[model samples]
Target: GRHQANDPRPSHFEYNGVRFGQDNLNVFAGLCAVDTPEHVEQMMKVLRDNGQVCTRMGAYKPRTNPYAFQGHGKDCLPYVFELAGKYGIKVIAMEITHESHMAEIFEALHQTGDPTGVMLQIGTRNTQNFELLKIVGRQQRFPVLLKRGFGITLDESLNAAEYLASEGNRKVVFGLRGMKTNMGDPHRNMVDFAHVPVVKRLTRMPVCIDPSHSVGTRAAGPDGMLDISHVVAQGVIAGANMVLVDFHPAPATALVDGPQALTLPELPYFLEDVAIAREAY
Candidate 1:
C-alpha cells in the first residue's frame, strides 16, 4: 500500500482537547439539512438526552439538483454555534467547498466567539478537489475530516489525506463512508469493513464510519434501528475510532437524506449498542 510505504504515519491528535486514537470513542451525530434555529434546538435536545456531545452539521450543502435544498448557507452557522454552546457540545464538523468559504467560516467563528471547535470536512464529492484541500490545509486553524470518495480506491483516499498533510496540517481524520459497488441489494453502497484496520495501520489517523449512508436504509421502527445498530456495532468492532450517524426529529420531512436519517426516538438504543461494541474492542 502506498500509505504504508511512503507516507509518514500520522500520530494521535486532539480536537478541543479530546484526543482521538485513544480509548475514547468519538460519536458524531450527523445533523444534515438543518435550516433553522428550531431544528437546531430539537437536535441539540436529542443529542444531550443521549449524552452525545459532538455533531457533523452542514450549513453548506452541495446538492445534485440546483433546486434542491442547498442547506441554509453560511448564515445559519451562528444558530448552530449558539445551540452547540447551550448543549455543551465540544466539536462541530462542517464542510468547506471553495476558497471563498474560508472567509465566511472565519466570520462565523468571529461572530459566534468560536463557541465550539470547528472541524473542516471535505465531503465525498470534494475528496479530490486538491485546490480546496490545499487552501484548507494552509489555514491550520482546525482539523480536517476527509471522507473517502464513493468510487475512489484506498490509495487515492490516502493520497487525499497526504495533500492536506503536505501543506503542513497533519490533524486529519479519515472517514470511510462506503465505496460505490454494483451490489444494490439493501444498502446504497458496500461498506468495506476490512478497510478500518487497514487504514489504522497504514495512516495511523483516526478512522470513522458513516453507517447511515453506508447501510442506505430508512428507519421504520425498532427493526430499522436494529439494522443500523448492527452495522454500527460491526464498524466499531472493526477498529473505527469514531462513528457518524444521521438523526432527525422527523425524517419524513427532512430536506436532505431523509431516507437514511434515523429518527430521534431510536438514537438512545443505537448509541447503547455502539458503546457496547466499542467496549468489546
Candidate 2:
C-alpha cells in the first residue's frame, strides 16, 4: 500500500536481547506488584533459575478502587533493582502513571549503577494519557510498551501509540489487554487474540498479548486446560511476538490481581506450554 511507502521506521524493535517480529518468543512474567523484598528476591530467583530474564513488576499500580493497593511506587524501586541485578535480570517491565514516575525510575536506575535495564510500561489505565505518552516518547533510554485501552477501539489505541512514535521514540511495542465490556462475561474481557494479525499489518510495532489480563483467571474450564494456558496458546499461534503475564510467589496473598496471578510453582509447566505453542505456530 502507498501508506507504508513513506514510513521509514523499522517494522520491529529489540530489547533485552529479544527482537520482536523475529519469531523469537520472549516471555515477560513476574509479580503484578512488588509486595516485599522477600517476594522480589523469590521472584527474581525463580526467574533466573528458569533462564528467564525479562519480567513485569508494577511499582506504580493504578487501581480502579481508590482504596485498593496502588503499588509501592518509588519506595520499592531500590530493592527491586537490587534484586533484579542480583539475579541477572536484564529488563524489568514496570509501569509509569505520571511523568514524574519516569524521573523516579531513572533516579533508581542511576542509584543502582544501572545494573539492569527497565522497559517502561504504559498500562491500560493510562493508555490514552496523551501527555504521559508524549513524555515517554521523548525518552530514549528505555523502550515503551503501550497496552490497549480496556474500553477504546483498536484504532484509538494505535493512534495513541503514534503519539509516542511521533515524539521521536519509535521503539514501541503494542500490547493487547482485552476490553472492558460484558460481552465476554464468564471471562475477564473479550479475548482479543483475533486482532494479533490485524495489529501486525497496521503498524511497525511488535504486538504482544496479556493473556493474564484478558482471561482474568488462572483456573481451568470444562476443557481442563488452564484459562491462561489456553489464552496464551491463541495469541502465540496467531502471530504474537511477545507475551506479558502475571506471576507471584503466592497468588493467595498477592496485593493486586491475585486471583489471576499464576503461582511460581507453575512456572516450569507454563514455560513448557508456551514453548510448545510457539512450536505449533
Candidate 3:
C-alpha cells in the first residue's frame, strides 16, 4: 500500500543543519569512495571553500564484482574524519553493508571524538536486506539514506523503506538511484527522477536524487548538456530535497567508477548549474 498523501508522520528530516525540503537545496558531493589522503583533503578543501558541508564518503562498498576495489573500509576512517573535521564538513553519508560495520563506524566516530557526523547509508543492493534494515533503523545516532533498490518496483522499494521506519527510525531520506533495467539504454541505469514528486506525495519522507549513479557517466549528450547536469536539474525541479553526486581529484585514476566521477575543477560550474535548477524549482 502507498503511504497516504497526508500522512502525519514528520517529514522534516535533518542532519548537521541541512533540513531536507525545508532548507535550500542540499548537495552531498565527494568521491564515490575514499581514495588517497591528498585526494580526500583536496576535495574537502574545495567543498569548504565553496560553502558546502555535506558529502558522500563510502567507507564500505557493495559491488557486484567480488574482485572490484571494494573501498578502503574502516582503515581510512581516521583521516577521512580528520579531513572532514578540518574542512568544516558537518555530515557524511556513508554506507554499511554488514551489521558489524555499524560498530566499526561508531568506533571510528568515538576515536575522532565525534567531530563530524555520519548519516548511515543503505545502498540499493541492500534495500531488501531485512536484518540490516532493522539494525540501521534501531540506531538513533544517525539518519538513514535508503536508495531505491536497483532491480525492484517503486512500490517494493517504498515497502523496503517501511522496513526501516517500522523499526522506529523515521528520519529516513528515500534516494532515487535509478534502476538496473536496460530500458535506460546508452546510460548505465534508467534515469528515474520523474518519481521525485511521487515519492514525496506517497510518503512523509524527504527525497534525494543520486544523479551519479542514475546516469553512471559524466559524459555530455548530443545537446552538449552533460548528462549529470541534466538529470540533476530534472530532480531539483521535481522537488528533490537533496542531491548526491560524485567528484574526484582525478577521475581518470579513481579506483572505482572512474568514468562516472566528475573532475574536481568542474565542481563550481556543476554547483552553479544545480543552484539554477533549484531556483527553477
Candidate 4:
C-alpha cells in the first residue's frame, strides 16, 4: 500500500548522532572510481576546503561493461576509514552490493577500529533487491541510503523504503537519482525534481537529490556544473534534505563517470549556489 500523504511516520532520523530533516541539510560529495589512497586524500582536501567533510566514497563500482574501471574493492576500505578520520569527516557512505558483501564490509570496518561514521548505500541498481533490503533492515548498526532506480515509479521507490522499515530499521534516507526517459538530451537521465516535495509529503524519511547522475555529461565538454547546480538548488527548494554530487580532483582523468563529475575548481561555486538555495527554504 502507498504511504498516505498524511501518514504518521517519523519525519526525521538520526545518523551517527546527527539529525537530518526539514531544517538540516546533508551535502555529500560523491567520489566516483576513487582507486588509490592518494585520490582519497585529494578528495578529502577538496571537501575540507569547501567546509564540507563527508562524501559518498565508492568502494565498489556497479559497471555494465566488464572492462570498466571497477572501484578499489575491499582493499581500499581501510583507506576510506583512515583518511576520513584524518579529515574529520562525520559520515562516509559506501555501497553494499550483496548480502555476502555485508560481512566483508563489516570486517573491514572492524579492522579499522570502526571509523568515525558509516552509511550503507543501496545503489540505484540494487534498490529493489528485496533480499539485500531485508538483510540491511535487520541490521540496524548503520543507516541506509536508498537511491531511486533509473525508471522506477514513486510508489515503487516508497515500497523499497518500506522493505527496510518493515524489518524494523527505519533509519532510511531516500535518494532521487532521476529517471530513464527517451528524451534526446546530453544528460544521463531525466531528473524528476518534482518528486522531491512529493516524497517529503508522502513519507517520514528524509529526501536527497543526486544531481551528478541526473545531469550526466562529460567533463571534456563545456562545464555542466551550472546545470547541476541549478537542479540541486531546485531540489533543495522543492524539499530535499540532502544533495549528493559527484566530484573529482581531476575529472578528465577519472577512471569512471568522469563526464558527470565536477572538477575540484568548479565545486566551490556550485556549493555556494546550493547554500543560497538552502537559505530560501
On TM-score, the leading prediction is 3
Which stretches in model 2 have alpha-carbon errors above 4 Å?
1-8
Give per-residue CA lDDT, model 4, range 1-281, as digits (tens).
Answer: 23676766667777775677755788889587676788788888778888885788888888999898877788888888888878878788788888766777788879888765778889999988999999999998888889998877788878999999999888888999888888776677887877887887778888889988888864232564367777888898887888888888777788888878887787688788888988887
Measured with C-alpha atoms, the lDDT of residue 211 in candidate 4 is 88
Regions more than 4 Å wrong, model 1: 1-10, 219-225
Candidate 3 displacement at residue 94 in angstroms: 0.6
Better by TM-score, candidate 4 or 1: 4
Spell out the clash pairs found in candidate 4.
217-259, 218-259
Over 4 Å off, model 3: 22-24
Compared with the true structure, what per-residue lDDT tens digits does model 1 show for residues 201-264? 7776889888887877763446644566777888899888878888887778888898888877
TM-score of each candidate structure, all chains considered together = 0.92, 0.95, 0.96, 0.93
Residue 116, model 1: Cα distance from true site in angstroms: 1.0
Count clashing pairs, candidate 3.
0
lDDT of 2 by residue, 1-281 (tens): 21373467577676666566624567999988999999999999999999998889999998989999999999999999989989999988899999999999999999988878898999998999999999999988899999999899998999899899889888888999888885548788888988988887778778889999888887797988898999898899888888999999988989999999988898988899888888888
What are the per-residue Cα lDDT tens digits for candidate 3 across 4-98?
76566567866677676523468999989997999999999999989999999887988889999999999999999989999999989999999
Give the Cα RMSD of candidate 2: 1.7
* Full candidate order by TM-score, most accurate first: 3, 2, 4, 1
lDDT of 2 at 222: 93
